[model samples]
Target chain A: MIAASFGAGGMNMLDSQSRDLIVGHGSHRYKVDVHWGRLDPGRVPVKDCHEMAVDSQGRIVLLTNHIRNNIIIYSKKGKLLQSWGTEYPGAHGLTLMNEGGEDMLYITDTERHEVIKTTIDGRVLMVLPYPAEVDAYEDASQYLPTETAIAANGDIYIADGYGQQCILHYNARGELLNAFGGKGIEEDKFENAHGICIDTRSGKPELLITARQQNKLKRFSPEGKWLANIDLPGAYICRPVIKGEHVYLATIWSGDGAENTGFISILDKNNRLISAPGGNQPIYHQGNLSPMYQQLQLFKHPHDVCIDEDENLYVAQWNAGHLYPFKLIRI
Target chain B: MKAKHRGHSSILFLQKIALAVCSIVALWGCSTNKTFSQENDIRLSAPIPQYSSTLFEDSFCLSFAPGYPNSHIHFTTDGNMPSRKSAIFTGKQCFTQSIHLKAISFHPHLQASEMVEIDFLQVKRLEKVKAISLLQEPSDSYPGGGASSLFDLQKGSLNFREKAWMGFDEKVVEIQLEFEKPQKLSQLSLSTLQDHGSWIFLPEKMEVISQDGSVLSQWPIPQLAEAKRLAYLHVSLDEIETQSLRIRITNADVIPDWHPGAGHRPWLFIDEVILK
Candidate 1:
């Protein structure tokens, strides 16, 4: 176990000169630097820093609900490079995709009940409104999209997590192709389908949707068929970020959904929990992962995690005193 | 003159080194003190109790959250604050009667967490209850297994979406309980939930009236500064004998101004009603 050497005072002095606090276990350990993304709140204020993505330029882009500046761009070294977008008041999810040499972003706004496709520089490219075509939705109010995942073929998958609890699949031209997984306790259904990501680790694209409240990730075929479930036990994972042979998730809650008990979960290529940063060490007995809980107060409510090329992690939080993201330098 | 200048410069360099050492010592001292203070603020997470229901019959097995290495969970059944000397919870405990269970988690290097308390009522099953009816229907969103749920020995969690809680948004709710014969009743308890974050509040008052139109007991719930989890409100009756009883629950007309749902009608959720 890592010793609890640093305290609240050490965190406050987390500039370049302070000693590093190492967290996590095994090969996934990181040097925690809480002030890596600090910005002057007056000049670039944020509220509920929801999610983040890495652009083609390697610059970290943050999506927040604050209308003053919805998207804040920062360099890998934590320097503020640019900020834009006043339109996304409920910007909750961000997915950056490099389409044939052009970097595009898909922003899901819950308040607008729409998934917007925009250029990296904040210009609107396409808008996919509420899927009124779905029989479960009566109006646009019942379809609050929280996250979006784009497949390699430009197919879009949106998770209506805060609303009807369904996953809407669309083609490249924003045409609805299929919608499935409504609210239920069934294997194919979802409770809080908060996030979605296309997993191509097996060399074939499959949808990994977050059944967050159930503490499991429901895998589905591209056509919205049940594939399998990756049970995370006590981790209320927000989304799955597949990089290389690992799956990184920002667990928003741990241990019966307690408040302010968020952590980061890392899974091996076989979907087994290997490490949990800010949480108890992952243990498995006879192939069943033990229930995990917060072991440290390193995070409040981690909403999303962005991994850079150097394997460093940028964690954005939700309702965590409106603080900026914390950078976890891989050790 | 050159040698004297060199001597002065050497003295200045020594002073600078001494100042750096002093600053480092001061910073280290400050960091150590902050670590101690922060360690004092580190609280163990409250242990969650696992039970089918708070209302149980005969003996029920109650277990708590799994313990961590070097940490202990102490508990008491007599309503007192749990201390280090309290009974250590190893596994499921069997209880035969109503108890106010309070538990606390303690670690050698961290502060003890706040007490997590619950009142588990040992109900008699009320075999004499002939029928139960509600004057006004509960909200469709939360029917809570119908009016019979009041005596069904089911308990609701903090989540209102659970089917065990009967939620009402109206200003008042009336329930009638018919008995096979006149039975002596001394105490009446109602298990309710209060989650102001979800606009669910405890009732303002509750009245138990006899079949003869006389008020047997009345309880005015005190307004709380903040929301709490599940609560068990008890009212002492005057050992009244009646063939039937009427339960009148008055909901809070408006949420307090301090709440986010101020001026809006608050919901009232009740799960179990025990007559002893």
Candidate 2:
């Protein structure tokens, strides 16, 4: 790493370098590094890097829609390790779960309207097709799953964000258990339910679903009953990635829903926003969050953020000129 | 004494030359690190503007996005392009008359951003209108307050999902406005939005007809480059006197082939209609 002093004369030189750019608010500052995961586009092309996750061996695995190579694995120090898979034309979401001391992957393909379970090395374990058991879906074409959350008991919860806007629950054997939450503006219904994850911070596993277009995160019981709602005005959040006591999300758009306005949002244990990396400082007045907007042009259309064991952040973008993931080294 | 003074003056001149050389070397080092390619890659984004409405009766407050360190926002009110020498916007400004505003952002080490322009119109209240009704209804998804929305004097943002915009997918839309008596009118302005990402476009053609079904005036919109923003189309009426008028709007039958939604029906959105 190159470090330079920003004296009276060399201010312009230090301003242009990305290594010296530190972002985020109090207690969560980070130094941005744009050249962390850059690779040759001709050899390994990427089209809309959607999501990322870290495996058991501490490898960063990224998912893209490019049919050439859908999954690209990298080391923590920005080295290309391996790549695999080509069948997922619409590979949107990637979820990693440790089962029986082995890491398993859940890939959601929007074009195929299904979810597939695979081992870390790209071996298919099981496939869950469209939920014909649900009455809201007339056929398989109406169920376009975007994300999935696996429970401790091997149960699966899928969010059909593009199609019927319903959350489908299934057992470990790929059998449908319960389905709820259709498309509407009501408190129980959802609008653009793009992501889902299980939050265990409260000692009980509750479903946290992303209502992206409405800029809200809804909480539901394990049996699909509405619990509460967290309102984030002007933030079009994508997914909920839970760490030890905080929740990190990638906001796709903010401030009047304009294009190419994105930021990273971090919430504390009490579910209140604490820091926003590329946005304004989080301010609350009488237990309500003020509207948030992009203050710095650091990211465009950020889709997901993966936090490593050291609390560093890896951000993946969509429709940002096919750029690679940017790394935020914790300061 | 003269020789000693000359020697001291020469020493001072030499020291000034050395300092000048050092300053030049420092500037050259900074230039080498900041290449032209790198400057082009990280251009600053245009500032986002906020206002209560584009059409106001008396006045409105215009504000910009939040600020950051080492960046400045400059603006102009006469429709000229904004430059670094323009007025710096410190906070929200109140305007009392119609004006065309343009703004741009600049940073220390990055290229300047493109200009953002908006037009705010000062309108007069019309009390001669009696009843207004829509002959053709809008889409079910975007009702937008029904027929009263056209005369509500409110404007919608770029997000078409907002309730102020009335979206129509039909080929032809007709609206009837009846006055208590015949009134003289010279111009008509309609506020619309064009957000290609959401598949919303402006109307193709507009016509004003008298009570006898005779065309009084017409305006045909010309095809232009694709842009995502709001617009105001002004139509000249020639000061014709009429009690009842029918305003007809035509939508594009098929979207252009270059768009993502090619060969599909284009949506037309209108928020408010004004008569002067």
> If scored against the real structure, what TM-score would every candidate get?
0.83, 0.82
- For candidate 1, the docking band is incorrect
Clashes of 2: 0
What TM-score did chain B of candidate 2 earn? 0.79
Please give, for residues A136-175, the per-residue lDDT of candidate 1 as tens digits. Answer: 9999989889999999889999999999998998999999
CA shift of B255, model 2, Å: 6.3
lDDT digits (tens) for residues B6-66 of candidate 1: 9999999999997887678644333332221233344455666788888787877889756
What local lDDT score does residue A218 receive in model 1, on the 0 to 100 scale? 92
Question: Worst lDDT window (10 residues) for model 1 chain B?
Answer: B28-37
Candidate 2 reaches a DockQ of 0.11
Winner by TM-score: 1
